[model samples]
Target: MLHARIVRGAERATSYEVTLWALALVTLALDVVTTTYGLEVGLAEMNPFVNYLLPTLGLAGTFVVLKSFALLVGVAAWWTMPSKVRGVVPLGLALPWGIAAVSNTVLLAGIHL
Candidate 1:
Protein backbone atom coordinates (compact mmCIF):
# COMPACT_ATOMS: atom_id res chain seq x y z
CA MET A 1 0.00 0.00 0.00
CA LEU A 2 1.11 3.58 -0.59
CA HIS A 3 0.23 4.79 2.86
CA ALA A 4 -0.15 2.41 5.72
CA ARG A 5 -3.60 1.09 6.48
CA ILE A 6 -5.01 2.94 9.45
CA VAL A 7 -6.87 0.51 11.64
CA ARG A 8 -7.67 2.15 14.95
CA GLY A 9 -8.01 5.95 14.93
CA ALA A 10 -8.24 7.90 11.73
CA GLU A 11 -4.98 9.06 10.23
CA ARG A 12 -4.77 12.77 10.71
CA ALA A 13 -2.36 15.38 9.42
CA THR A 14 -0.08 17.04 11.91
CA SER A 15 0.12 20.84 12.19
CA TYR A 16 3.07 20.82 9.85
CA GLU A 17 1.26 18.74 7.28
CA VAL A 18 -1.74 21.00 7.44
CA THR A 19 0.41 24.08 7.04
CA LEU A 20 2.30 22.59 4.11
CA TRP A 21 -0.88 21.50 2.36
CA ALA A 22 -2.50 24.90 2.87
CA LEU A 23 0.52 26.75 1.55
CA ALA A 24 0.90 24.45 -1.43
CA LEU A 25 -2.75 24.71 -2.38
CA VAL A 26 -2.80 28.47 -1.99
CA THR A 27 0.42 28.85 -3.97
CA LEU A 28 -0.86 26.60 -6.75
CA ALA A 29 -4.15 28.49 -6.92
CA LEU A 30 -2.43 31.85 -6.93
CA ASP A 31 -0.06 30.66 -9.65
CA VAL A 32 -3.00 29.69 -11.88
CA VAL A 33 -4.85 32.93 -11.27
CA THR A 34 -1.85 35.21 -11.71
CA THR A 35 -0.95 33.64 -15.03
CA THR A 36 -4.25 34.84 -16.43
CA TYR A 37 -3.72 38.43 -15.30
CA GLY A 38 -1.28 39.58 -18.02
CA LEU A 39 1.66 38.42 -15.97
CA GLU A 40 4.36 36.78 -18.04
CA VAL A 41 7.45 35.04 -16.73
CA GLY A 42 10.26 34.16 -19.09
CA LEU A 43 11.20 30.51 -19.57
CA ALA A 44 14.67 31.48 -18.39
CA GLU A 45 13.24 32.25 -14.97
CA MET A 46 11.76 28.76 -14.65
CA ASN A 47 13.22 26.28 -12.20
CA PRO A 48 16.25 24.61 -13.73
CA PHE A 49 14.94 21.12 -12.96
CA VAL A 50 11.59 21.86 -14.57
CA ASN A 51 13.20 23.61 -17.51
CA TYR A 52 15.26 20.51 -18.24
CA LEU A 53 12.13 18.36 -18.36
CA LEU A 54 10.14 20.76 -20.54
CA PRO A 55 12.13 20.13 -23.69
CA THR A 56 11.23 16.44 -23.95
CA LEU A 57 7.81 16.87 -22.39
CA GLY A 58 5.58 19.69 -23.65
CA LEU A 59 3.93 22.43 -21.57
CA ALA A 60 0.94 20.48 -20.23
CA GLY A 61 3.10 17.44 -19.54
CA THR A 62 5.68 19.50 -17.72
CA PHE A 63 3.00 21.14 -15.61
CA VAL A 64 1.50 17.80 -14.60
CA VAL A 65 4.86 16.24 -13.83
CA LEU A 66 5.95 19.13 -11.67
CA LYS A 67 2.69 19.24 -9.73
CA SER A 68 2.75 15.48 -9.20
CA PHE A 69 6.29 15.69 -7.89
CA ALA A 70 5.25 18.44 -5.48
CA LEU A 71 2.29 16.41 -4.26
CA LEU A 72 4.48 13.38 -3.62
CA VAL A 73 7.02 15.45 -1.74
CA GLY A 74 4.32 16.94 0.45
CA VAL A 75 2.86 13.53 1.15
CA ALA A 76 6.22 12.01 1.98
CA ALA A 77 7.16 14.88 4.25
CA TRP A 78 3.78 14.77 5.97
CA TRP A 79 4.13 11.07 6.70
CA THR A 80 7.81 10.68 7.46
CA MET A 81 9.80 13.88 7.77
CA PRO A 82 10.38 15.57 11.12
CA SER A 83 7.96 18.29 12.21
CA LYS A 84 10.71 20.93 12.25
CA VAL A 85 11.65 20.32 8.63
CA ARG A 86 8.04 20.16 7.50
CA GLY A 87 7.28 23.38 9.33
CA VAL A 88 10.21 25.09 7.67
CA VAL A 89 9.15 23.94 4.21
CA PRO A 90 5.89 25.87 4.38
CA LEU A 91 7.68 28.96 5.69
CA GLY A 92 9.94 28.86 2.64
CA LEU A 93 6.96 28.72 0.30
CA ALA A 94 4.85 31.28 2.17
CA LEU A 95 6.94 34.42 1.74
CA PRO A 96 7.25 34.23 -2.05
CA TRP A 97 3.74 32.88 -2.45
CA GLY A 98 2.37 35.57 -0.19
CA ILE A 99 4.20 38.23 -2.17
CA ALA A 100 2.73 36.85 -5.37
CA ALA A 101 -0.74 36.80 -3.85
CA VAL A 102 -0.55 40.41 -2.72
CA SER A 103 0.99 41.54 -5.98
CA ASN A 104 -1.68 39.75 -8.02
CA THR A 105 -4.42 41.21 -5.89
CA VAL A 106 -3.04 44.69 -6.36
CA LEU A 107 -2.74 44.20 -10.10
CA LEU A 108 -6.26 42.85 -10.31
CA ALA A 109 -7.51 45.87 -8.38
CA GLY A 110 -5.99 48.21 -11.00
CA ILE A 111 -3.39 49.53 -8.56
CA HIS A 112 -0.20 48.95 -10.48
CA LEU A 113 2.86 48.71 -8.33
Candidate 2:
Protein backbone atom coordinates (compact mmCIF):
# COMPACT_ATOMS: atom_id res chain seq x y z
CA MET A 1 0.00 0.00 0.00
CA LEU A 2 1.37 3.40 -1.00
CA HIS A 3 0.79 6.32 1.29
CA ALA A 4 0.65 9.91 0.08
CA ARG A 5 1.88 12.77 2.23
CA ILE A 6 0.04 16.03 1.91
CA VAL A 7 2.10 19.16 2.13
CA ARG A 8 0.97 22.45 3.58
CA GLY A 9 -0.29 24.99 1.04
CA ALA A 10 0.56 22.76 -1.87
CA GLU A 11 -2.71 22.85 -3.78
CA ARG A 12 -2.93 26.61 -4.15
CA ALA A 13 0.73 26.86 -5.04
CA THR A 14 0.29 24.25 -7.71
CA SER A 15 -2.66 26.04 -9.18
CA TYR A 16 -0.95 29.41 -9.13
CA GLU A 17 2.28 28.09 -10.57
CA VAL A 18 0.53 26.29 -13.39
CA THR A 19 -1.67 29.22 -14.35
CA LEU A 20 0.91 31.96 -13.98
CA TRP A 21 3.71 30.02 -15.61
CA ALA A 22 1.61 29.29 -18.63
CA LEU A 23 0.50 32.88 -18.84
CA ALA A 24 4.02 34.21 -18.53
CA LEU A 25 5.46 31.72 -20.95
CA VAL A 26 2.88 32.14 -23.64
CA THR A 27 2.81 35.88 -23.33
CA LEU A 28 6.56 36.06 -23.73
CA ALA A 29 6.68 33.64 -26.64
CA LEU A 30 3.96 35.36 -28.57
CA ASP A 31 5.48 38.74 -27.96
CA VAL A 32 8.84 37.58 -29.13
CA VAL A 33 7.62 35.80 -32.26
CA THR A 34 5.31 38.54 -33.37
CA THR A 35 7.74 41.34 -32.65
CA THR A 36 10.55 39.53 -34.41
CA TYR A 37 8.78 37.64 -37.18
CA GLY A 38 5.85 39.99 -37.61
CA LEU A 39 3.28 37.18 -37.98
CA GLU A 40 2.40 35.71 -41.33
CA VAL A 41 0.60 32.50 -42.11
CA GLY A 42 1.97 31.07 -45.33
CA LEU A 43 1.87 34.34 -47.26
CA ALA A 44 -1.25 35.63 -45.60
CA GLU A 45 -0.37 39.04 -44.30
CA MET A 46 -1.12 39.47 -40.59
CA ASN A 47 -0.29 43.11 -40.36
CA PRO A 48 -2.03 44.92 -37.53
CA PHE A 49 -4.95 47.23 -38.11
CA VAL A 50 -2.85 49.92 -36.49
CA ASN A 51 0.72 50.27 -35.40
CA TYR A 52 1.56 47.73 -32.67
CA LEU A 53 -1.95 46.30 -32.90
CA LEU A 54 -0.89 42.98 -34.33
CA PRO A 55 1.55 42.25 -31.55
CA THR A 56 -1.07 43.16 -28.99
CA LEU A 57 -3.64 40.89 -30.55
CA GLY A 58 -1.14 38.10 -30.95
CA LEU A 59 -0.07 38.33 -27.32
CA ALA A 60 -3.67 38.33 -26.14
CA GLY A 61 -4.57 35.27 -28.14
CA THR A 62 -1.49 33.40 -26.99
CA PHE A 63 -2.24 34.30 -23.38
CA VAL A 64 -5.79 32.98 -23.64
CA VAL A 65 -4.76 29.65 -25.10
CA LEU A 66 -1.90 29.04 -22.71
CA LYS A 67 -3.83 30.10 -19.65
CA SER A 68 -6.74 27.83 -20.58
CA PHE A 69 -4.43 24.87 -20.96
CA ALA A 70 -2.68 25.62 -17.70
CA LEU A 71 -5.93 25.91 -15.82
CA LEU A 72 -7.14 22.60 -17.15
CA VAL A 73 -3.86 20.93 -16.29
CA GLY A 74 -3.85 22.39 -12.79
CA VAL A 75 -7.36 21.20 -12.09
CA ALA A 76 -6.60 17.76 -13.39
CA ALA A 77 -3.39 17.55 -11.43
CA TRP A 78 -5.03 18.79 -8.30
CA TRP A 79 -7.64 16.06 -8.43
CA THR A 80 -5.59 13.20 -9.81
CA MET A 81 -2.22 13.70 -8.18
CA PRO A 82 -1.32 11.96 -4.96
CA SER A 83 -1.65 14.38 -2.07
CA LYS A 84 1.99 13.94 -1.14
CA VAL A 85 3.34 14.64 -4.59
CA ARG A 86 0.68 16.94 -5.94
CA GLY A 87 2.00 20.46 -5.59
CA VAL A 88 5.70 19.81 -5.30
CA VAL A 89 6.00 18.18 -8.68
CA PRO A 90 4.25 20.89 -10.61
CA LEU A 91 5.83 23.72 -8.65
CA GLY A 92 9.25 22.33 -9.31
CA LEU A 93 8.52 21.93 -12.98
CA ALA A 94 6.70 25.18 -13.54
CA LEU A 95 9.04 27.55 -11.76
CA PRO A 96 12.10 26.87 -13.87
CA TRP A 97 10.16 26.58 -17.10
CA GLY A 98 8.29 29.76 -16.36
CA ILE A 99 11.45 31.73 -15.72
CA ALA A 100 13.07 30.45 -18.86
CA ALA A 101 10.06 31.12 -21.00
CA VAL A 102 9.63 34.62 -19.63
CA SER A 103 13.28 35.44 -20.15
CA ASN A 104 13.26 34.03 -23.64
CA THR A 105 10.27 36.13 -24.59
CA VAL A 106 11.73 39.28 -23.13
CA LEU A 107 15.02 38.76 -24.90
CA LEU A 108 13.36 37.98 -28.21
CA ALA A 109 11.04 40.95 -27.98
CA GLY A 110 13.88 43.23 -27.00
CA ILE A 111 15.86 42.37 -30.10
CA HIS A 112 12.95 43.07 -32.41
CA LEU A 113 13.98 45.75 -34.85
The best candidate in terms of TM-score: 1
Q: Which stretches of candidate 2 lie over 4 Å from their true place?
A: 1-57, 105-113
The sequence of per-residue lDDT tens digits that candidate 1 reaches over residues 49-69 is 756876798556776786677
Model 1 segments more than 4 A misplaced: 1-20, 32-44, 82-113
- For each candidate, give its TM-score against the true structure: 0.49, 0.38
Model 1 clash pairs? Answer: none
RMSD in Å for all candidates: 9.2, 9.1
Global lDDT of each candidate: 0.56, 0.52
